[model samples]
Target: MAKIKVLILDNDTTSRDILNKSLEESKDIEVVGIAFNEKIALDKMRLLNPDAVIFGNNFNDLSASLFTKKLLEAYPGKGVIIITDSNSKNQASDTIEALGHGAFDVVLRPDPNISDIEKIKFIERNLSSKIRCFSIKKFSRMARLLTPIEETQPYNGNFKPSCVKKYENSKFEIVLIGVSTGGPEVLTNLIPEIPKNFPIPILIVMHMPKIFTKPMSDSINRVSKIKFKEAEDNEVLKTGTGYLAPGGIHLIIRRNLKGELYVLFEDTPPVNSCKPAVDVLFKSAVGIVREKAISVVLTGMGSDGTEGVRALKENNVPCIVQDKESSVVWGMPGSVAEAGLADEILPLNMIAKRLTDLVMK
Candidate 1:
């Protein structure tokens, strides 16, 4: 794996130096450089090309937000963490704006007190535990709580119910979904309400850390009528069960001699800053199911699913994207919708019905 390169931008020489020193000792993170102000950060952004940035939210300007836009424009894939003291309201405003500009997440500056220092110590020492917990929580649920998609087709055999929207035969036999960032929330709303005996099975990819998927799967199963579980490698995608890609791995589908599709997960390096990258699964499924597949791109934080949607469209598979207002981050689904790659764009409230209707002939 390549190093997670990081750059720090803080006017406080003391704090900047301290953080630089701390992360320099990290095995997973590489401290590439540090800057005392926004201008220097921008200059080094192009020069250093770090994978992540830790910016101090204290800007010299009082009325205007800092270089959040410049940073986003310079490096679209770079992750960011804002460190701000509690003293400045502008700090929070800038942080939110930074997220709006495509920062990954935020963190608070730890107090200098011994207790807070001890907490940092605990976290630093338990880094493995934190990563593990997030991974396990990704797909632990077996049911979901949701409302039937309101504006689209219901699970019942309704509408034209044709693959081409004009035929009598239902064109969709497989439900393949791709998501990230806010995927857990999306699943909690859609999976539970899908009625049983719906015939088709669901295959999903939610970009997440390891140990987080199982808990999510368990939670979904308890609330929804259908069963949900993390996809076990080589497990068959069956009816009434929704398969989620395991965290820290790529979940793919392959066909046997009899044309049976089996779900599989592999521990490969992240394809797009995500282990369970939606693109990996979605692209694979397009070849496996072709015109019989119904692909849905849900709320997420990147363009990971966009290319996959393109692949689906090229192969005659019908794909949909979640509409903008319903998306939390709006990056993944938005790109596909904008590219005219998806056949339909609906809100979360209407997605299930649209999907179900596609499946009913």
Candidate 2:
């Protein structure tokens, strides 16, 4: 297998060295080049053709969002990870903005409290993992494009295309969404298409850090007709409103004494290695709304929503997953589709319309 070539983009010499050393420890990565400015970064990008780029938070001339946008336009498929400070709220907001501008992922610089060795380990654990996942997705896509149409057939095991099910009789009261990896770009495109008077509430659990969730919700709210914000504990769910689970915690839906729908937060250990696991939210709706709810699994890196979708399917709820061609990383939705639990496998552009049709009709 070819190593994932990487280019470091940072103005700070010390920061660049740290990033270089951290990635050097990974056998699967090769540091192809380093750039101290935007011009140099672009030059190296054209020259080296690295598989991914690690962009540090030291640029003075351009904002993260603009830089990410330009970089992506220049090189479409290459993964870009923005490094930000964990203690800086401004950087967190900027990171979310970058994601909205088509950045692949974000990683925070280690907290000051941790030791030097821990900082290196932190970068290795987080940054390296994202790059590796991106590499797998990149190569799989390349393989598909390179294969001849006549020679192409669905694999026997986990890669079989899902049989699409039409839910003509489906009536839904609430929407439950789980996404990761390439969620922000998809949500930014999907949410605003929903009209203001649309019925039913939406609960979203996107894999993100705690600080970024508020900014992410705020970013989406600016363009969305519906009210979008972080979920508040004990607040009643309302129509034309979307509530995103606060990161680093579980958001569970429950009924009040009067049988009204409300949300609650759980500090339980991370399920499927995610604090705000989709399975937790999906399972919570089982006894509360039973089959009245609809679950949508968007693009994400892991199979966090498979069990949740399974539980929902058993209760006769309709499950929709983004098709592999539209997903940035198809792990989560692919897992559900491979398990034969998805009721509808739709493209990104069509998901919002399908939901509106299923619920409004």
Candidate 3:
């Protein structure tokens, strides 16, 4: 893979320096330029033409949302990742607004009080991965648009959904969706499409900050027919409602003596470097839901859901993966596809329809 050229925009000297040095350590990324403000960043953007822009927590003139909008308008397809202050009271809401304005992803900046080593470690673990993943997607889009084709199809001649075996039992008790990277934007579009009378309860695991889940769920619920909210501990699973795993916690499924399924929360360390990991949620349902569950792997970075999906497949559960042409970052769903675990590989626009077909049948 080619190195991802990155431009850094930060007014804080110390913070900017740390970001530059930490990112420089990554072999997958190259620091093309560094700007102390958005103006200089814009000037360098034309010259450097970096694959992605990193927006620092402190800015002199524009908010992340405004800057992101400007960047996208000036250079469409350039990925923008915002760095938000962890100490800010409005961190969650601000990140959501930034994403809404077209930012690809957001990461919490380490506290200023933390040691320089700690800050470096934080950036290495969080920000670098986002940049690398975003670059893969950016390049993929460029290749698709630049390469001319006779025709476009979901899959090539040798690829066949019919060749894959799926659980024959038609019964489905619940639906599990695992998404990341572009999850927030995708979920807003998807959840509203499900009708109010949808019979099975849906459990969603989205990679996000702990503070963001409640607001995200609330925002989706406002326009969605099915009730959407952050999951509560030991809450009985209910049909016609969708449950989202709270940020920074694992959502587990357990069956009670009455054979009723409910959600449980755990503060366990992150699996696959993600709290509220898709793998954690999917694996939890292996025995509890068995063949009675249908799982969907949507747009995300990394292979978080592949292992869990394998566990689900072993138990005869059906899995649906979002196709590469429709995913924002195809790491998660792409992994499932490569592993031959997906029963169906459909575009984003078609996922809700297929889901309804499977559940409504």
Candidate 4:
């Protein structure tokens, strides 16, 4: 029942005042403080401990990444929402970069439309809706072509915990997946297979519009025994739970005050052509889990995961890609596979089976 306090961070005075007025007027959100630059932002952050910080990414000058990076080091708990007037392309690219720098969400603030639609209804629907109300849809779709990783391999993948040869180990602590187009269907199929008692946490970055992700996560939780929730800034990654990054925001992994890894959501623009991008999460896990990490890039429509997958591969972490046949759009996964970054390329149907096999081994 408590109001969520928000702090506004922007260099523009008019922008700050407008956001202050808008958030202060809302019953759900309380405007705590406003800052115009990094120095002022940090000062306000120390004194006000707001629940969320609304920062802007669009710049007539330099981007907001470095400032965000410094701000996080000092004030790590405030939920970060990065606002930008970027198109889908630049949004995705910057999203990847911000997550790597430890940002949480890449949010697209509405640009001045020559035509206003009464109010900012679109963003309100996407960013403000309750996500835990929907029914989870069953996994219905299948890929149209080849299936090798599913057929040829048992789940005991090339994973070793104490040694480099075992790229995947049985003692998996977390399941971090980066997905794009057609990801929901793939997840619906894959998540139900993760036992309710599964001992690791699962995190997904399914690139989508912010409005739909909450409902999508809510729907997913309905079918799976695992508790599912849309990620919040600094929320823990407990086992037997699944988290979906809110669309339009980038999700990153961070250690909490308890020293446990938790989620950080950002509202900055997209990185690598998409917010909730694979590149961001994959690259983060490289450091978080090192050899213990398992990065999977499923079907999507862009080359977003290519660089992130490469980072995982270089770290000797096992990187899996949903093969071309199983993917609705192959841009995301295909680039990783073509770059020789994937340790296993599996079909849609057997990805769960193989994962089970690997984790159980």
lDDT of 1 by residue, 207-279 (tens): 7544456655766777777778878888877877888777678888888887788987777788877788888
Candidate 4 structure quality by residue, lDDT tens digits, 91-161? 44454445434444445566566233422444444333211001011111232322334455554544322
Clash counts per candidate, in order, are: 36, 0, 0, 38
Give the per-residue lDDT of model 3 (tens digit) for 238-313.
9989999998899999999999999999899999989999999999999898889999999888899999999998
> What TM-score, computed on C-alpha atoms, does each candidate reach?
0.59, 0.88, 0.86, 0.57
lDDT of 2 by residue, 1-361 (tens): 7899999998888778778889999998999999998899999999999998899975767667778889888888788899888667788888888887667788887786877678788888899989987887772242232233235442222321333234546677799999998788778877887879889999999998888888999999999999999898888999889999998999999988987789999999999999899999999999898888989999898899999998887778888898898787899999998998987787666677778877887
Error of 3 at 213 (Å): 2.0
lDDT of 2: 0.84
* RMSD of candidate 1 to true structure, Å: 13.6
Clash number for model 4? Answer: 38
**Every candidate's CA RMSD:** 13.6, 5.4, 4.2, 17.9
Deviation in Å, model 2, residue 214 alpha carbon: 0.8
* lDDT of all predictions: 0.67, 0.84, 0.83, 0.66
Highest lDDT model number: 2
The TM-score that candidate 4 achieves is 0.57
The candidates, ranked best first by TM-score, are 2, 3, 1, 4
